[model samples]
Target: MALDPQAKALLDMVYRVGAPRFHELDVAQARHSFEKLQFALRPEMPAVASVTDVPIPQARAADGVIMARLYRPLSAGPDEILPLTFYFHGGGWCIGNITSHDVLCRELANHSKAAVLSVDYRLAPEHPFPAAVDDALRAVQWSLANAGMLGIDPTRFALAGDSAGGTLSAVTALAQRNAQGPRAALQLLIYPSTDILSQRPSRREFANGYMLDTGSLTWFFEKYLPEEDDWQDWRASPIRAARFDGLPPALIITAGCDPLSDDCKAYGEVLREAGVPVEMLEFEGMVHGFITLGKFFSQANEAVLQAGEALGRAFAAGGAS
Candidate 1:
């Protein structure tokens, strides 16, 4: 499929002469660039019942505490306990913070009628590999353990994220399954980097022209994984996990033109083969990162609606079970 005109226009603007790509800039500059794009393209923030910043105390003292923002839908009653979706924002695990995804979390809460907890996991380079993964797992566990206090239904918890955040979600879900911890009702992965070691066709096919280019990916990986052998770790690459049979059902969203598309599809196939239910949605003619750019792409809004519906159905089933 041809590139969506809006995506093409974004690419044209991003790649205009003298514009510095992410790989060309320092980490701070790259993050600023990424945030600028998100801020300019994200839709206006919708009203929600409440938004609270919660600090999650890490199990390991040295890891300190991570922050998460919880959003309660406008329709939620003061005393009602809602299903919870622990959301991790994307930025290759290096750039984005809770504020970057505030609006998206609000939309998810309203549309899914679930409380959305947007986690601010420690970023890369300084924190490095396993840091974000550890933070993600800890946040979920903490949230589940204290669900009553947060006004969330512990039995109906879900995990959700996009891109690197999606990777964290997948890894965290796998870890929870392995540990026999509280199982998530669903896993919402949008353009997730399932395999860092992937050499799939889509990696090369959409490598350069897409918004998330090969250079930027390499940059992210390098910053996050300073150890070469960590690339094979299941936490870093969920597709490398030993098994997937007992994992939660997944809604895997992919962009047709994304370099990570094939890897995402492969992960879905792996889940299906293991007898785990999987729903895969591919946004054709779209590039990576379009889901958060609802201001520029109509499909972004459509995708969010689909994701919210999936979360609602999964939470409903969980509650019944």
Candidate 2:
């Protein structure tokens, strides 16, 4: 499909209004910029189920401090727990926070009508590698364990994220599968960083000039991974996993113009070959993080709604539905 005029205008505006996102900024500054963009969007989103930040007192990771903002619809009131999504924000695992993804979460919660739990996991290089995987796993387990208190229907829950956040989402599902932890009904991965190793042609083809340039990716990866060796670990690279079988059903969203596009496509294809039910979409002319640019890009909002529609179809009637 041709580039939507709105998409082009917003893309140009995003490039001009601010600087390309970088990993050099501290969490506070990065989050500030992210939140600024979110507020700028003030998008016309559907009236959601509901939204609130519920502290999980029992969810302290191996280190400490594990809290997630829980989102749901009004129908799924405090008394009714609904299928949940343990959502992680993206920023190469160093920048984004719940506040930054607040609108996206709202859109998802309103559209998916599930208990969307946006996690605030520990970032790096302060806490690297397994720390992120551990935090994500802990968040999922904590949500399931406290499903009652969190008003989430344990039987109907999913896991989702975008970009680096998408990487963590994939890892969380794998950890649950291998350890026989609570099952996630579905996995929603949006332009996820499936593999840290830049081995694909798209990596170079779409690398430099795109919104998420190869240069920025390298900088982000360096800050997140203490050593290059960490990329080999399956925790850092889901594509390196020995098997993707028996994992939850998946919804993989990719950008036709993204450097990591092939990696995301490869994951969906591999998962399907492994006997998992999967759905994939690559929006042409879109770049990395198109899922979160609703403020500036119409395609961003459209992608979210499209993903939400799929989630509704995948999760309608409940987890088994």
Candidate 3:
């Protein structure tokens, strides 16, 4: 498919601006740049019933705590026990945070009619490989244990995120599936980097001109996984996992122009082949990271609504064990 007009315009504007790309910046600069784009282009925040910041105690004593933001939809009653989605923000596991994804979370909560918890996991470069994975696992574990106190339904809980955040969601869901006790009912992966070792056609096709360029991806990987061997770990690359059986049902979203598009599709195929229910949605002509730029792309809003509806259906179906 040809590039969507809106996406092309966005790309043109980005190139016209002559700003340094992520690969050219330091970690702090990259983060600031990412935040600026999100702030400038994200849709207006949708109203929610309540928003709360909750601290998740770390499993390791030296790791301190993970912070998360909870959003309850306006449709939800104050005392209602709504299903919850644990969201991890995408920034190649290094840049994005809860604040950057606040509006997206609000939109999801309002549309899905489910509470959304946006986890602020540890970033990379400072805390490299496995640290983000550890925080993701710990946050979900803590939330499950305290679901009652948080006024969420443990039985209907799911996991969700975009890009690197999506990778974490998949990894976390996989980890939870094998462990005794509660497992996620659904896994919503949006243009996730499922395979760090992927050499897919999309990666080559969209390598340079797409919003998420090859250089930036390399920069992210270098920061997140200084040790190249860690890239093979299933926690780092869920597509590298030995099996996809027993994982929760999945809703995989992909942007046709994204380098990770093939990764998302391949992961969905793997899940389906393993007998896991899989629903795949591809927004043809869209670029990577377009879902968060609703102000500029109409498809972003449509995609969010679709995602929310999918979550609502899963929740109503009582979710998988």
Candidate 4:
């Protein structure tokens, strides 16, 4: 499909105004550049609860002191036990937080008719790769061990995130499978970074113009990894792992114009080949971070709805588990 008018408008604005020459800029300047790009997409969005009618509160992961923003869909108030989604916001695992991704989580919670726990994990460069992964694992562990306290059903929860956060979600699943961590019902990955290699054709082809460019990605990788070898570690680059068997069911979302699009495709293939029930959907002509742009971009809205529906089917219907 051709680029929708709204998505095209977004690309035009990004190239025309938001694209910063961060090559020589300081770290703070580059961070500002990234934030400006996001703001340019939509200067502001309604509060998460307004968008999805969810009650939002802050929770803490006991071990790492990781903060988690819990979203209970208005459709399911206190006293109503609902399926849960533990989400990590996407920002190459180095940036973004609960507020940056609040709207997305609420939509997922409301649209999927399930509670959403949007975790605010520690960022990279300051905290780095394994830190985020560790926080994610511990958050899941705490959620399971204390599900009753949080009013969640331990057996009815799932893991989800976009981009690098998606990497954490995927790795968290593998961790559970490998170390026998708390079992999640399913995993939802939105254009996830299953591979840290980032050398696929999509990365090269969309390197310069896409929302998440090669240069920016390089910055993120540099900031997130503790060492070069971490790039190949399964915890960082899950697609590099030898096996993905025995993991939970997965729904992988990919964007045709995203630098990491092929990562999602490859990961979906890996999951399927490993006998994990997997569903893959690629949004053609769409750029990276479509989930965040849905308010102004029609394809993005459609994609989120499709994703929410998929989550609903996977969790509520209780299939493919």
Candidate 5:
């Protein structure tokens, strides 16, 4: 199948400008470029009832605090304790932050009718390896413990993210699957990198012209996990986890043209085999990050609607429990 016309046009324009690929720049420059591109490509921001910034303090002052931006849906009642999605934005664990993903978070909140808390976890190269993982786990824990303060329904909490952030969301579900730990109602993964080291067919099939090139993937991995051994760590690659038996149900979304398409499919299948209910959707003709480019892609809204409906179902089930 051919690439979506909009996707192809965006790629053509990007190449025509000769914009430096992410792999061509140093970490700082790459981060700046990524944010600029995000701002330029994303649609006009949707309205949410309210958005507030809150910081989750770390035990060590040196580690710094993680910031989260909260989005309350326009339709949510003032006194209602809404279901919540604790989201992490994707930038290969190196770039992206609350500001870079602001619009997407608003859309998710609006469509899901759930409060969204987008975590600004520490990036790599500076934080590296377990730092992002640690911060992500901490954010989920903090959200669970402080649900009342945040005016969210603890019982209907879920984890959701894209790309590296999606990886983090999956890893968090595995990390907190204890009897005493907070149980996530759902795990919504968007084109997640499950097996960081696995060279699935899609990695090569769509490696070059797709929005997320192999070179950029390599660059991100090199910056975030300099040690080759880090790729095998289950924390870094959730697919390597000892078990997925008790993890929450999942809705894994992939783009057929994404380098991670097969990886996501594999993850979902393994989870299903382990008796965890899983639903995987591959949007043929779409590219990685299609869900964020609503201005150019109608499929973006379709994906969001699907995700929102899934989230709603999970929340309702959680409430029933």
Candidate 6:
């Protein structure tokens, strides 16, 4: 399918404005550009009951602290303990922070009637590989252990993220499974990159012109991977894992024109084969990262509502629908 009209228009505008590609800029410059682009694309912040910041100390933080933001919808009562969605933002694990995903998190919280915890994990080049993974798992453990203080219902927890964030969610689930740790009710993966080694057809077919290009992916991976061999590690690439059994139920979202579409589909198939319940939604004509640009892409809003519905069902009593 061709790109959606709004997605195409946005791409045209990006090119016309001569925006620098991710691969062509330094980390700081790339981050600034990414934030600026997100700022222009996102709609006004939606009204949520409340948004607050909490500090999470990592496994070995000398003086640094991982930041997390919690979003609660108006429907949530002051004393009520609600299901929590621990979210990670996408920027190839190199860029993107809570601020860039603030509005989307609020929307999810509002629509799902669930508390959303957005993690600002350590970034790449400076922190590299297992660092983000460590922070991700730690955040989940922290959330579960400190549920009461955070007003979270420990029994009803979900892991959600986009792009690189989605990758972390998948990896964290696998880690928890192996450790017999806190289980996530559902894993919400949006246009995620599952296989670091496999070069799927979508990667070649939509490698250029799309908002996320092949070169940019390479740049992001280079920034995140500690060593070349780390690419094959299951924590870095969940597709390379020997077993997908016992992982959480999955709600996978894929964009028709995204380079990572095939990656998400293949991952979903693997999960289903391993006896994990999976629901995959492919938004035809949409490109990667469309979910974050609701102001420009009508499909973005639809996708968010769909995600909320999925969360509602998964968090409902008696498990997945």
Per-model TM-score versus the true fold: 0.98, 0.90, 0.98, 0.89, 0.96, 0.97
Residue-wise lDDT of candidate 5 within 90-174, one digit each (tens)?
A: 9999998999989989988888899999999999899899889999888888877888899998778889999999999999999
Off by over 4 Å in 1: none
Number of backbone-clashing residue pairs for each candidate, in the order shown: 0, 6, 0, 0, 0, 0
Shift of residue 240 alpha carbon in model 6, Å: 0.7
Residue pairs with backbone overlap in model 1: none
- Cα-based lDDT at residue 163, candidate 3: 97
Query: Which residue pairs show backbone clashes in model 3?
Result: none
Cα-based lDDT for every prediction: 0.92, 0.78, 0.92, 0.76, 0.88, 0.90
Which regions of candidate 5 fall more than 4 Å away from where they truly are?
178-180, 319-321
Ranking according to TM-score, highest score first: 3, 1, 6, 5, 2, 4
The reply for model 6, stretches above 4 Å from the true place, is 61-63, 318-321
Candidate 4: count of backbone clashes, pairs at least 3 residues apart or interchain: 0
lDDT, candidate 5, equals 0.88
Q: Candidate 2: lDDT of 133?
A: 86
Model 2 TM? 0.90
Q: Which ten residues in a row have the lowest lDDT in candidate 5?
A: 312-321
**Candidate 1 has what TM-score?**
0.98
* Candidate 2 positional error at 91, Å: 1.0
lDDT digits (tens) for residues 257-320 of candidate 1: 9999999999999999999999999999999999999999999999999999899999988651
Write model 6 residue lDDT over 82-134, tens digit each, in one string. Answer: 99999999999999999999999999998888999999999999999999999
